[model samples]
Target: MGDEVPGVGAHARYVPGRFADQVALVTGGGSGIGAAVARQLAAEGCARVNVADQDMDNAESVAVAMGGTARHVDVADADAVDALVSGVTRDCGRLDVVVHAAGVDDPEAKAQLLSAREAGEPVDVLARLGDERWRRVMSVNLDGTFHVLRAAVRAMRPRGRGAVVTVGSSAAFDTLVGYPHYAASKAGVHALSQAVAKEAIAFGVRVNTVAPGPVDTAMAARTPAAVRAAMEAAGAIGYASAEDLADSICYLASPGAANVVGAVLLSNGGRFTV
Candidate 1:
């Protein structure tokens, strides 16, 4: 089975039927951690999976592979997010789980910092970060999370049962020197998730966050070598794979986490101590 499955490991275990008859929506399902979650949900027999992403090509590919539906949505837009949720609920008759994994980091800012360091100039990220760059990162990582979470919560509230697992960053709690924008945005995400979890759980909806440390992803691949090396060493397990994150995310979205609410599950591989 491992030899036949593209991304599956030789020892990977799947809980077939765990999500059977349930519908799921995964934002940023085109690639990386989101893609991994989408695949896992399908493997577990989710009735309908909505793969929402801005990149339609990648989204469509993953959707096709898992027999899910691909949706084109830029999560930073509230109306788009609302429509995505409504459409899924309207079509599928229910939305049992939502994994909000769409987020962005400031690679350009990291590049500038690295370049300044190489030239022996004092690197002040705040001084160098442009207003537009900072806003863009916040818009995607923080605002996008807000839009998705709000819309999902509303859709699930009426049902009286649902789960939402959002992807956060360990950087939210730690200092990612050159990425103040990224850190700030993710911090907002963590706080927002907890606040909403309190309210949403009252409606029998569960909202939680999975804060990951250094994960080997396409975004990570773009980081400057110096920055990448620091990240690689930051995690005790070197670096986690996107699939590793997916595993944690799926658990948070499953019945196993039924009693868990307003929690931030750190899947950072010992990057930090709570």
Candidate 2:
């Protein structure tokens, strides 16, 4: 179309208004790709966008600026996820689309990996990465996705038509080196989305995922600058902005993607094509 439009946050980009009149709920809408997704949804003509995140302040900031509602939620908690979905449906009357952008990092992995290098200690990646770190990341990224998808299906089944887009990572298909937990969680996310798509299809709900490579986000900042630069040099298109990923997500949720079920729309800037 060779066109563009204003987005909600500093990270988003312009897009068409195919989403007009739809109601969307975006989890992890406080910042990064999630924030950008909420903004794109708003700019694309969503009548109401519920910005759900554990960080109420950021969620509120994004929601208020975009003329949508803010919600405090921990997607890892099944009950809380269900409640958020119910509340949005009860108040907004219907949820035409859902985008799950909530994912977590392994703080323990980062701290240990960085500290060992800083202290001149022999870096043992596995030794430093405890079981807790793995579980925590999986809980938030994989389990949380399951919870949100399940809840959304329950609500959408009654309506008999809906669309869902979950944000995943290119790391799932490649190596993330020191962050095995994060990689594993994202891999599970892709598998889970496909499984859910199969189940939800019978209910008229289509579920899919957008897997982006190293994008310019706080999460990417965790990588050592030297390593990031080296990786970028090897990549076909290097890193992309949050808006790029958001653009793909909005496309998947829009009517143009009505038949793109159980698919993973990879927006990795040509780094990983799978």
Candidate 3:
């Protein structure tokens, strides 16, 4: 940690020098947990941060606020992800951290359940709980992570040093009935990160995952009140905020976590206590 860190505005927590001079690229950096992580990293003194998202306007707002750069990237598109990586490296000179936080919720699944309760609609035949939904969820959560990690490793291996923090979900290890697809994709993310860490150790790269539980983000806002209450009651600390998860991501991206490779750091307010 250092004094007078770069991008810490009034609201940031303890400023840390963990990422001084590092260049970080955060996907889905426009809002919620991704945005919080970006702000935290910038506050910690990373020299350059590329805040990327599918929405350029949102991304630009975040980047500008953070005093960083913004890039529009569709993570599902491997070519676009590669180009974004190349562009960031070309412009910034080096890459040190990669944080993938892009994600989506199953609105259709939620709708079907709501309809079943309200109008006696058959929940099994919901339009949103099908193959297409599964594909989209996996495409962004798992495949998108792969695309970014692939490009980042290509850049990091040459330097022989880098850190990657992928965002997973507590659902990966728990039973989340309506969001089976989301849970499966996040589980795949954990497995993928572990495999990457195993292969990358020799190259001096570390890959880890952060599986957050019921974070107070837009996603959590969409959860039913009863479900949210249940999650909160089950947790030792009731709720975890985006910044709480961001702190863990920052730690994984730091030199202090050098020995912490291929690990899944759970920031779930004791919801999935080991």
Best by TM-score: 1
Where is model 1 more than 4 Å wrong at Cα? 1-11
Could you give me the TM-score of model 3 versus the true structure?
Answer: 0.91
**Which clashing pairs does model 3 show?**
1-17
Per-candidate alpha-carbon RMSD to the true structure = 2.0, 2.7, 2.5
Worst 10 residues of 1 by lDDT: 2-11
Q: Provide the global lDDT of candidate 2 against the true structure.
A: 0.85
Pitting candidate 1 against candidate 2, the one with the higher TM-score is 1
lDDT of 1 at 52: 92
Ranking by TM-score: 1, 3, 2
Q: Give the TM-score of candidate 1.
A: 0.95
Q: What lDDT tens digits, residue by residue, belong to model 2 across residues 135-179?
A: 889899999999999999998999899999998888888766677
Worst 10 residues of 2 by lDDT: 1-10
Q: What is the Å distance of residue 157 in model 1 from its true position? A: 0.9
Q: For model 3, how does the per-residue alpha-carbon lDDT over 20-111 read when each residue is reduced to its tens digit? A: 88999999999888998898888877899899999999899889887989999999999999999999999999899999988887876655
* Cα error, candidate 2, residue 31 (Å): 0.3
Better of 2 and 3 by lDDT: 2
Better of 2 and 3 by TM-score: 3
Better structure of 1 and 3 per TM-score: 1
- Quote each prediction's TM-score: 0.95, 0.91, 0.91
- Give candidate 3's error at residue 37 in angstroms: 1.0
